[model samples]
Target: MGSGEHDRILDAALAEADTAGLRGKAVTPFLLGRIVELSGGRSLEVNLDLARNNVRVAAEVAIAWAARR
Candidate 1:
């Protein structure tokens, strides 16, 4: 997906995480995995590094989404 749309999805995933009251390290990967699952399947196999990046991206996107709200 394009960066813009990807960011939008990440934002939505973050919102979902917030609504679900998820915390700690697994939240992002869980959200990311769910996003992938909903879109299709697990295209990218999750790993430590990828999970870490997902967490970062989720946080960034979530913050941006919140700012717009």
Candidate 2:
């Protein structure tokens, strides 16, 4: 999804969570679930892609650092 759409979904989810009085540790899961619902599950797919990309980047960084040492 475009960044604008992603931001809109996140803002809407956060607003709903706030209205529902979600706080502390409860907020993360609530927001995630709301985002998924709001985005028609697209958010979850994006999240998984981001996670995998992060792992790949971390491994690349580690390899580069090791080579320099």
Candidate 3:
């Protein structure tokens, strides 16, 4: 994704987190995981590191086709 697209994706994900009433690491992980999941299938991952806080969060997502609900 380009910088602008990446930014929007992040923004939407953050907004999703806000809607879910979550913040910080929790939100970051869920957002990244969904983005990765949307991008592909079997194996997808996103890593976020907070340099100032020296914390890293990584998520791996896998998707399978769903039969009718």
- Per-residue lDDT, model 1, residue 30, is 80
| lDDT of the candidates, in the order given | 0.74, 0.94, 0.56
The TM-score values for the models, in the order shown, are 0.51, 0.78, 0.48
For residues 9-56, could you state the per-residue lDDT of candidate 3 as single tens digits?
667767777889997678767986766664443223233224423332
The alpha-carbon root-mean-square deviation between model 1 and the true structure, to one decimal in Å, is 13.4
Residue 31 C-alpha lDDT in model 1: 87
What lDDT tens digits, residue by residue, belong to model 1 across residues 23-66? 99969688877678654543354445689899999999999999
TM-score between candidate 3 and the true structure = 0.48
For model 2, the run of ten residues with the poorest summed lDDT: 38-47
- Model 1 earns a TM-score of 0.51
Deviating ranges (above 4 Å) for candidate 3: 38-69
Candidate 1 CA-lDDT value: 0.74
> What's the residue-level lDDT of 21 in candidate 3?
94
Report the CA-based lDDT of candidate 3 relative to the real structure. Answer: 0.56
Write model 2 residue lDDT over 1-69, tens digit each, in one string. 899999999999999999999899999999989899999999889889999999999999999999999
